[model samples]
Target: LERIVADVGAAVVVCEAATREKVVAAVPDGAVVVAGDATPASGGEGGFAPMVAPDLAAVIYTSGSTGEPKGVTLTHGNMSFVADSIIESIDMEPSDRILCVLPLYFGYGLYQMLTCVRLGATLVLESGFGAGGRIVQLLEEREITGFAAVPTIYQLLLSLPGIGEHELPHLRCLTNAGAGLPTPVVRAVRSAFPDARLYLMYGQTECQRVCRLDPEEVDEHPDSVGTAIPGTEAWVEDEDGEVAAPGVVGELMVRGPHVMQGYWGNEAATDRKLRPGRWPWERVLATGDLFRADERGYLYFVGRRDDIIKSRGQKVAPREVEDVLHAFPGVRDAAVVGVPDDLLGEAVHAHVSAEPGVELEAKALKRHCAGSLESHMVPKRIVIHAELPRIGSGKIDRRTLAGWSPRG
Candidate 1:
């Protein structure tokens, strides 16, 4: 955003605290300044004249590994539209207190911040999602009304020793994102939080969130990624370019106010995904995920495009294998991948991290898979690593850790 202000022939006005005071001062004073959490004792406004920009608001960046990260520029109209939509769909009230662990830079986390600010609710900011004890304590301390996290945190929290029933009663609800929750993890979470609402959502960074499974619909249709949020349009397009019939796999596409404008400085990437070609709307964000819709209109997840594997002319979903692996005793977490093969086009491989002191061996785990999975579906090899690879957001980076030799 600072770069955008400078490159767009405008100076950036920033507000910061003592630690960031030097950073903001470095910017040209010719730019308009606004103080955030760093105002003087009197709380007086800056002397500079306020400049108004219509529909345009600042962008927040998350691509930390990349050089010179750019912000996602969302207009005022866009912000108002999505925020109103979320508040309406979830029926958010001013009394709600959200436990926010995600930082403001992330759109998911930023929406949490915006929702709290707009609803006049309390935002109990956490340093991070490390374990359950701290969070359990905070929920009681702050009377937290809600929570949100990716699947990885769900697995960790579910596995924690003290996260069982009665530890957290004040939690009104919890949300999951970033990745799909394995069925086992989902069931485990249900057991842990018997009272709190559990919403299994599916979405990408390009679009904040599209589908959400409400708490009531969980038991009747736990696997279904709940119907599209109100005020949003959802359709699955097959390879033939038409709405997919019920029970048929298709690419999930979402059209709504929450969708992002485009990628930063990457017009081609934006054009590839956000094309308004066939959709009647002004824009649509095409998700790469493959999912099937049941006759009743609930969305059922299959797997990611890159996560599918083909073996001996038969297509296979790695998640199916991973799901079976998770059901096995002693297995803590697992990621399945397809490796190169001589007979088949690809060979199924399983990489797992087991519970501490569980005494699970490669052969025993293989036997466990053999009992549940078909002969063809069984993994040819299993690799157990000490720890899984993690990206900037602390979720598993499978591409980086897959195929690496297991820990001795």
Candidate 2:
């Protein structure tokens, strides 16, 4: 937080009571530091301030999965556009109540609150997703109409006893983003919420939402991230910047009002991302993610261009292997990476954590994956760890694992 404030040259800092002194000491001289819970002055009138849609609203930092985090500048229009699109796509109602388990600092969690307020709905904010049973209890007690989470959250929820047996009639929708949910986990979610609509979404911090798959299409296109959201255009571009044909892998590009203005104080990076479009006045985001499109225009994530692994003259996505690993019974969490190998160029390696009291053998895991994954997609090596490392976003810290050695 301090680094971000310093980098952005913020004029004021608002924080909770516990962090007021720290924020005051860290902010620039003459910068105001206000308590988040402080009451307004008596003379102050309460009303909406006059502002234009293009005015800056907030700056969100990327998760820094690849390298240093970059601050994404968003305007009032950007957030408002995304919130409205999501509300329409999910068919949110004014009386709907949402249960948010993600951190408010993250875009996925923040949008839940934004959408609720826009629709005049209720929001039940939890600090984090605790034990599965506790979350189920909250669902039953609160009568939540909507639930939002990432793939890992659903995996944990499905691990709980009597998960599929529980009745959640009030939960009308379940939305997922951050990373693609495995096919098995998607099935588990369906079983858990039989009557609810399951929405598989794809996005980044730069754009709050890019695409959304309808519940009816889940069975037909289980791997697709769906088409572009309303008022947005998404496509895959080849190395020469031409639109790639269906089933051809290329970087994904998105153009919409929800796209961020640019990276704060990073013009070079901004130029690389927000580049020229078909028209001189238009700018589209060149997402560094690799993806493929179906004949029907549904998008499927391949992998991050930098994260994609080359082995045996073929490309492999870590998520694809990780999905297979997650399907094995008693597996709690899993992460896949490419390791240096003279024979295969880059060998597929997996690190998995098991549920408490469950024993996992590398040989058994390999045998389990052999049934589903292609021979080239199977892990060359498997390691069992007590827990998989996670960063602030609750995503597996692949960079840390990439350089890790058991001997060290």
lDDT to native, each model: 0.73, 0.88
Candidate 1 residue lDDT tens string, 213-289: 88898877766778888788777778997889998888888887767777666687678778684557588778777
- Kindly list the per-residue Cα lDDT of model 2 for residues 232-315, writing each as its tens digit: 999999988899999999999999998999999999999989988779988999999999998999999988888888899898
**TM-score for each predicted model, relative to the true structure:** 0.82, 0.91
Identify the candidate with maximal TM-score: 2
**Clashes per prediction?**
0, 0
As for candidate 2, its clashing pairs are none
RMSD of 2: 2.7
Every model: Cα RMSD to truth: 4.8, 2.7
Residue 221 Cα positional deviation in candidate 1, in Å, after optimal superposition? 2.3
